[model samples]
Target chain A: MAVINNKNGLRIEKADITLGFIPLTDCAPLVIAHEKGYFRNEGLNVTLSREASWAGIRDKVGLGILDGAQMLASIPVASRLGIGGPKIDMISAMVLDLNGNAITVNNDLYEHLYAIDPRSEFSPLIAAQALQCVIEENKRSKRPKLRFGVVYPCSTQSYELRYWLASAGIDPDRDIEIVVIPPPKMVTAMTDGDIHGFCVGEPWNTLAVQQQLGHVVATKYQLWNNSPEKVFAVSESWANENPVTHQAILRALLKACIWLDKKENRKTTAKMISQAPYIALPEETVALSLQGLSLKHHGQLPEKVEDFHVFHRYSANFPWLNHAEWFISQMYRWGQLTTPINIEETVAAVYKPALFRIAAAAIGLESPSIDRKTEGNLHEKNMLMKSQHIGPNQFLDGQVISVGGIIKYLEQQSLSKADIPALRLINIQKEA
Target chain B: MKVLLIDIDDTRANKLEPILAWTGIELIKLNNHNTDIYQLVGEMHPEIILVDTNSPNRDTLEHLAQLNKASPRTVIKLGNARSESINRLAADAGISIYAIDNIPTKLLQSLIDITLSYFYSIEHLRSEIQSLKPEIDARQVLNNAKKFITETYGLTEEQATDLLSKNANRQGRTITEVARQLVETGSFI
Candidate 1:
């Protein structure tokens, strides 16, 4: 492998590193970095290990067993706040990708939803309200509650699923059950009648739809456009100790993201990631997200979504502090966090946009100059402008998640004193 | 009465159900095999968890860690003999007792007793070590040994720690004992 000198004159602390990733289409950047010799060009040896679950990724990264990992966008924030897992002071300087997740419901649920509303537009609110009807019927009939699956308790899938449901007046806590099912087993679980629906990343969603086990109700793009999905995360201590290495990794990943965004390269990238060592799914299944084709539903016509997955376009790699705050607000809104936390401090400690800026600048990539932006206020007129701002990032309910808005939202929800036992059940672990 | 059995296939369940029944440990077997094991354990409030599988995966151990957080329970894993590193990983992931390979049904009860006693003693020692100064030096030595093993064998830090513990168990010694040997020799088998 050819080695290039550090052009930025920064000392590389560690040349050899191992990064962890769950087997999913969104882990493409890390795989592309290693396979395309991006890491080798910077004088680094990168080993990409396929992790079993998000929790395993969190634990291994937290314990310093692995240097860094492709983590759930909320994992670092939740870990820092000590909400769903151990407090590990994790940080993410760059986001891996955006909006590669979809909500998939089993065939039975899909039929029920379609029967309720056979509309062409895949509106999350409409689907959620139909789900509300199913939930009420189940309650009235004294049947077992409908169980839905998210990849992790502290994940974008969890928040998005909850947000979408709550928008339709369905109480996620009492109306149904939410469980964590690893992405790989989601289709099987849905087929086994273990879960009625799940919100997860591709190609699991695509795979389920293709297998005729489920249908896509809504993509994350429909719920919240270009929402932060997976992030490249490491412990804060790891970053402090290996600043140069971290920057180098970030630069390589940014280049990979750039390489991935080219429409012509999507086919090859899809084929590359579908190998057994990487995502291990069919190339066609992985290609569906990359080619930006309409996702096929069980009964409804395919929905054409162009921004299904954005890797480098519109400064998608930059870690936004506001995104972190939005997650914190969601955590509070859903009763995952019962105590008030300083959102500014948590964002400062976990979302390091300055580091991302340095890496982007070093690689001659233009990143968002500003570190924060108000979410849920994008219009088509300003969509193509090349500024630090990127959007179409609106919530289904049209509620803006600004700093003050989150504060007011949390206060209105009274999450600090909610004291819901079912909410607290998942967080039973003693602090380590 | 709160006992949870996970991944216990019908064959093992058939063999183990009678044994557990005789002991009056009402086993609440998990039927949903795809849900998060840790979250299920949290919801069920199982005081004791028994997992039977071919080998424990990273998900299993990670869930065990989560289970420990919600409520520390006596966990027993019965399966085929995995690599020493895997056994070590299982232990680190919070399985109190990891019994590799099948054992005669007659010895199962006695094994449980010994495992319970062993867990208590280790917990007692852990608390004592938490308050001692020498423990810090020992930890440093262990850390150095783990680093050495990781660099030399190209194993992950978790895997290296597992190897050390596995060696210690095989030699009928403690982790500190095996760590000292690795630290002194600067090599691990």
Candidate 2:
């Protein structure tokens, strides 16, 4: 029962590790890290298995069923705090990618966003405004406010959607209701009119726009440039026993990042990720700009270079404590979990910079010079999210009380039957 | 308070003998296949209703939704649906809650009391506090049926719940009864 630390743990470089990944667009680096022979190059043996759900991914890692897996950035924070289901100490050795997520309004909503704004000129911020406006306008028309979807409760997709919506003066809870939907079904849900819109990660976002079921109103990276998204994660115990293996995997994955980010590899990577076995998306839907260039949205080259998914280059491989803590701050803000924790120590423990540094130095790259200071622009002064009424920059994480009493507080906010019409709609609709 | 316990398996009545031991309530178990359980639920007007998960006999939650309008006094307990994520997600999406088996004796009674007291009222909510004296306990059973269907079949919350309801009803038993049918019969369908 002694505390876990580096003193007596098994070195990661000495062990072979099994990594888990889901077949999403961003799992590319982890898969590519293995495919490109980076693991072998770094003196590590790695195995990759595709998982079904984020819960399965978390549980397998928690129970030591798998060594580690690709995880949403919020997962490590949520798992340690024991938020979503159970608490198992997990850590991130490196960020998998950023951006590549967008809020797609259903076709009806997209058309309204375009037609209603007198200045039909597109802005994620305006589309955000339009979404809020439509909800309010619907209230006047007595139509039910929209119910939007996010992939999971503990995800950047939910937070970013809330952040993006709030920036536009929309109340995420009141103006619209947010629920979880699996990523693969998001576009179909939008097309079927089961949900008004959704915030999800890659290929799906691309799917919505291409199918004309929805439009990408906001990219997570644009809302907050280089915002931390997914991570390559492992359980604390696994990391402890397999330190050498962990470091080797990180080094290998870092090399894969470098290779994936290159212009020549970008096209091949897009085609590979889009295959039926991966995201099950058509290659045309996932076609990243063949030139390894930036995305063109609304006839504009997004001013943010980090708006698309980033595998290698920059400080991508160096797991930042700030990046991890920022999500804690967000979890606190969104009331996902209660109370603020010792952000510095917890984030530091979870980010696993020691392993990251070892991996980086092994790959002949300089580690990030910034050791502790926060990165990225937390201040979204220029952005307009859909749920703006919940904001005005005061308590941005929307955390008033600390994380200590979160469940009780958030439970109090649970919707009553009167708040939204009871789900007897099936019966009512069945009769009607 | 009185509870109407409807099970396709007659033995559950024997198993539940201890559950209704101390409470100021009467437990009535109807395991017969031909019983008009839904009509009886409305007629008897029990404070809480417990139906077998396998009842091809009834869509208990769906019936609860309907009963809530005519007789808001009756609250139905979908006790066996808490085993899986798809079930949990389905319950959460449907704005209801279920209690799966294997809960501790105390917690199980507390869950029964919560349903007996009705969830929305200040009085039932008042009972919720006393039941957890030291501190509030928030624990729900891990619905295996939910986990089984979601992981094995990749079914959504709505789909999994619907499939369970349909199969159970078609077999003319409770959902728990039908679930066991699935398990005992040993075919995934």
Among the numbered candidates, top TM-score falls to 1
Candidate 1 residue-wise lDDT, A314-360, digit = tens:
67988989888778878777767767455677788999999999988
> Highest DockQ: which candidate?
1
For residues A335-418, could you state the per-residue lDDT of candidate 2 as single tens digits?
564443455567777887777777778667877666444333234454466231111222223333222322232233223112
RMSD of each predicted structure: 15.2, 21.2
Scoring the B chain of model 2 against the true B chain gives a TM-score of 0.37
- TM-score of model 1, chain A? 0.92
By lDDT, the best candidate is 1
Task: Give the least accurate 10-residue stretch of model 2 chain B, judged by summed lDDT.
Answer: B89-98
Candidate 2, residue B166: CA error in Å? 69
Sliding window of 10 residues with minimal summed lDDT for model 1 chain A: A423-432
